[model samples]
Target: MFVRTENFRTFTKLYPIITTITAIHLVLWLIVQFSENFLHLTVGYNLLVFQGEYWRLFTPIFLHESITHLLFNSLSLVLFGPGLERLLGKVKFISMYLLGGIAANVATLLLAPVYYSHLGASGAIFALFGIYFYMVFFRPDMLNTANSQIVLVILAISLVMTFFTGNVNIYAHLFGFLAGTIMAPIFLGKGTYTRSLSQIFPNMRRSPSTAGKGQSIFWIVLIVLVALGALSRFM
Candidate 1:
């Protein structure tokens, strides 16, 4: 489910919302790179938020502090988003994404000091993981055994990294995940199980032996990318 086989045009056609949001990520990051004022205005600054600049909560969902930050979160959204988008439909999917992000920002506002500020879509990305986590236990029919294992392993690694890594927004990741977990039942009630990835690329189905290899490769590549992203922060 994590593998992407779609070409750019097909992918955009299939998952317009994901494509558009990723485009927004890129565009906003470029704008922020050149314009310090825009970055300050949109970043999730607790002081400004507490003083009634309410939009920070929402705007920060689309902003990132660096190119590496943008690429990591956007790559995550691209990899994991389409399945849920297909399952939940456009409206509910976007709703869950936004709610997860906004919830994280709100948590940051309440818990962090006045000087604290953050920018990225990690909160929303973790929210997607939260939904997958809920599926692994409660809605097993929605994901195959391989996908379930992938979700659990990746989530475990991510949570560990969240605490260990520097310059990370712990509040956003934790609360966004919580919000998605709580919201999953509401969004997924009585929905029929559908493997959107297989439907999109039926020809890519693999035998059990090859499937295991594919999963192993996926884990390796994803871990390398995540490690690079973490290391980039220090560099």
Candidate 2:
């Protein structure tokens, strides 16, 4: 006779923040595959963006134009997100992801040709890569292990792909990397979490507010979107 016991230990190591975010992206893509209307609503349309559907700034990061796009970005997020989350903690990590994607979308909408639609989470993944890139330089300990070497190789391949690929949003990737680098000093700072946030935006220090660092990100994102949307009109 033989007996087998189920194993749940592996699941214990999974990062909930990364898993949940990935699930949402995959689920949204599934819906778009089945529903054309959703596909239309999700893509970053410049006209609709300026028309006050400011959500397009953030949502486009969740929308993938093709299955290949979804798979590549989803895989990158799943692989890179957990390590970053552990490094920065969940709240700040998610903020970086959102800010990266939003910044990339803003750059694309404003700088790319008008009527040029953009979508996909490569921007967010690039943000993660940006943080990793910073680590490779400033935080040498982060790349002390063997895993980091693999990540560096992966990033190099991605950079090459971004330049050669036709439909890719190169601008989004570039801006996302920049955004991540900008936020890294805060997320990976030496001080306490609150102090780190204050470094990111000095204004946060002025208010006697109860809002956490992550909550402040929403307001920052909103203000940036509104300001950029208005600026897009003039440009």
Candidate 3:
């Protein structure tokens, strides 16, 4: 799961996309178990109507109760991460992973039972699907034109899979898709991949740019909103 400079360079030099994705899949698998155990040690998650443990929202993404389920998520994560990471780089890619997953948790809490424990990378992968589609079809000029139609076709097929498949976490996927879609227009262009976090945070003035001190405010607000949203399920 860990990557050293040599391994990164060697793999990135060969199968840059696939190799990076494989690494992410491995790491995520480990994190899922760790998250579940951590939650049990602290808050705990339920099988259904998931306890408003709040942490369950994030932890569930890490644990897959079954091997087949893990396999599907790993495959999808590996397939999705490389393409998106190669484009978004490590920061935005990581942001997409965490934010998309959080977005999924939000949707799951709102729509499903609070005790219904859920886990998988479907939300993040779906976000990648949305972002990839945007980079390809919505902004084809950003990349080579030959890949544009191909990417669009792939997006269509994946969207169809959600509708046809029975247990594909379609709700999480849709939520991730919407989040990624909303962010795409803000960052999409024919230049280096970049995102502006300051736009969302209202207090960054022209001077005193050490916004690091206030980063916690972001999480505070996010968690508060999530907490309030989760409460709606019980009422």
Candidate 4:
């Protein structure tokens, strides 16, 4: 289910919400890269948020601290988001994504120091994992065994890295994941399931033999990339 068989054009058409969000990530990162002032104005500075700059909670979800930060989150969204987006529909999917990010920021505000600041979609990305986790355990029909294993293993790795990785917002990741898990039952209720991408685009679908190998490779590559990305913060 995590495998992406769609071409660039097909992917955008299939998952417009993910495409738009990733575009926002890129655009805002570019803006912040050139303008430190904009970053300060928009980043999730807890004190500023407490003083009534409420938009910081939502805006920082799209902001990134570095090129690696941007790519890691964006790649994660691209790889893992489509399945949930398909399952939840556009409106509900976007709502959950925003709420997860906001919840993480709220956790940051309440739990972290007042001077703390953070920017990135890791919290929101964890939210996606939380939903998948719910599926693996509670809604088994939603994901096959391979997809289920993928979610569980990746989530475990991410949670471990959350603590060990430097400059990470541990609260955001944990709380965002909790929020998604709590909200999953509501969003993933009966009748929410939709046609898989393979069903919709028969011509593009891979044979089982090819798909199995592709998914294995995809999973390994994603894990390696995520691990390397987390480790790269030190280098």
Residue 224 lDDT, candidate 2, scale 0-100: 46
Quote the lDDT for 9 in model 2.
44
Model 2 clash tally?
A: 0
Candidate 3: list runs displaced more than 4 Å.
Answer: 1-9, 12-52, 189-235
List lDDT for all candidates, in order. Answer: 0.85, 0.70, 0.57, 0.86
Over 1-235, each residue of candidate 3 has an lDDT whose tens digit, in order, gives 1112245476567445456555655665566556865435332234433534566566555555444555555555643456566566677777776677778778877876545555666686677767766665456445454334434544665676667665556778899877777666665554345323232233435354543434434335434433432332333
lDDT tens digits by residue: candidate 1, 1-235: 7877789999999899999999999999899989999998899999998899999999999998776787778888988899999888899999999999999999999999999999899899889898987887667688776787678778888898899888899999999999999999888864455444343234545665666666666777787768757874775
* Ten-residue region with minimum lDDT total, candidate 4: 193-202
RMSD (Å) per prediction: 5.4, 15.5, 16.3, 6.3
Candidate 4: where are CA atoms >4 Å away?
Answer: 190-211
Cand. 1 Cα-lDDT: 0.85
> Which residue runs of candidate 1 sit more than 4 Å off their true CA positions?
190-213
Please identify which of the two predictions, 1 or 3, would achieve the higher lDDT against the true structure.
1
lDDT of 2 by residue, 211-233 (tens): 55554553454344334323322
TM-score of each: 0.89, 0.73, 0.60, 0.89
Angstrom error at residue 205, model 4: 29
